[model samples]
Target: MDSTKCQDHEPSTKLLNPEGPTATIRPIDFTRSPLADDYSSFFAMTIDNLLTPDECARLQAAAGDNWQTLSKGNAFRECQNILVFSPEWASALYDRIVGHLPEEVKALRKGDRLAEIVVGPSHLKASVGARKTVWRIKEANDRLSFLRYQPGHHFKPHCDALYARPGKDERSFLTCQIYLNDAPLSADGKSDGGETRFWTSQVGKRQKPPAMECEPAEEKEAPFLDIKPKMGRALVFQQRMLWHSGQEVKRGEKFTVRLDLMFERHFEKLQPNS
Candidate 1:
């Protein structure tokens, strides 16, 4: 058993198709938003119709039942997922969003640009890997994790974890989650509960998910923002200090693809002709 098999689901050699993004940006600026941030939050954004319902459906179909249960053990993420190495998909998705990102994001990609961002629980240093600053954004890393949350499946409230290749001077700083199917509402336009929720309340600032998988806690007092699952929608956020969860899928199955932003550490911002 190597990095390829023996899992509940095997990784896909070829992946899904990403179309030209055709959506406007909805910026989530923690610094200005009423959303309480123990520390000033960096920029997070969401886009509607980044691809299309048809495109999303095709991708999901292509991944048809190839998912392996990733919820084994006490995993915070309870879903069936498959790993995809799709540089083309990554590139297409990045092209759609890169032009719309805040200039700071592009600058950060140039490396050594953003000042240390000590926000949330994960403090940042003058570095660009796990536990580093997320004030920057770059092209998408070529790995995509396709996730499927059937009824009762969910992800616990926790910060996104960062990763890097063994020796690459690059690391992931942002998470781009693309929802495939719409978690439809009731007949009368009433709401059901499948949402990716962002918890803004300042609580035990644990950087990692629980050591073991456990049941969700009873309802408590904490403010949270719910991003409903709409087909073709893409949610981009910093994987730094923000605490979030995939609210339990009480009804329908929710399909999503998790992509990432890779920050280059060996690069630098070139000054204009000086």
Candidate 2:
């Protein structure tokens, strides 16, 4: 696909911030299957030029002043920093997202179908002679986080927390990530290995998912999905079900913005497992 054409076609709207510079949202012209039969109607979509290069650079610069090392349980190896946008900016962006959502998605939200709402359609139809699918954004976390991954930095394979605990009212359903810049090039003139890797199980109904190491495997029997970070690209997927990780950076640096799309689900009986 022509990056120039995609960039030119992006709709200029007051979605992200009405007062500040406008943000664009464009559909990705790619094909990716849903995770399972149950989620066949649901869509996982990636959009390009969601944030312009200038916007990404500004966010990256803001994060530089306050880079915080992230931890996984007790390990402080996973590194990142949280970015807090102004209240006006946040509210405007959220409202713009709500405005762009398709009617079907709005109906699901109105019905309080938390499960279906979490994995709603993408709303983007396939190109000629291609399969058809729909995509949409049901919700997003109040805050956005900026992460910087330098050489050798990586996040191990793990599923995101399903629920945000009782009384929190917020339950994590999907993860949305936007790349600030392209993957750094190496001495060989090739992009470094900082792709996000997703793992799936071969055996049916296993008690737990298989474990993934800090580094990428040369080969694996189970199904896997690898996504390369590119400037202005955004990826959204099921956070609780997909086992994924941020691969180790081989050179330069990788920056991204991570946001969780959540909903309020009140459990009648909160069990330990629930």
Candidate 2: give the clashing pairs.
Answer: 121-134, 121-135, 121-136, 122-134, 122-135, 122-136, 123-134, 123-135
Best by TM-score: 1
Q: Model 2 misses residue 221 by how many Å?
A: 4.2
Question: For model 1, how does the per-residue alpha-carbon lDDT over 10-53 read when each residue is reduced to its tens digit?
Answer: 22323334345467788766655446554354557888888667
Local error of candidate 1 at 183, Å?
1.7
Candidate 2 lDDT tens digits, 1-274:
1011111111224223234334444432223433343333433456566666776666556444556666565442466665654343344344534443344443323223433434322212122233222233435664567788988788866655553535763455566787989988888877687887666522244445322113222334545567789886777665534556787888888988777665543223223342
TM-score per candidate, in order?
A: 0.75, 0.62
Consecutive 10-residue window with the lowest summed lDDT within model 1:
1-10
Estimate the lDDT of model 2. 0.54
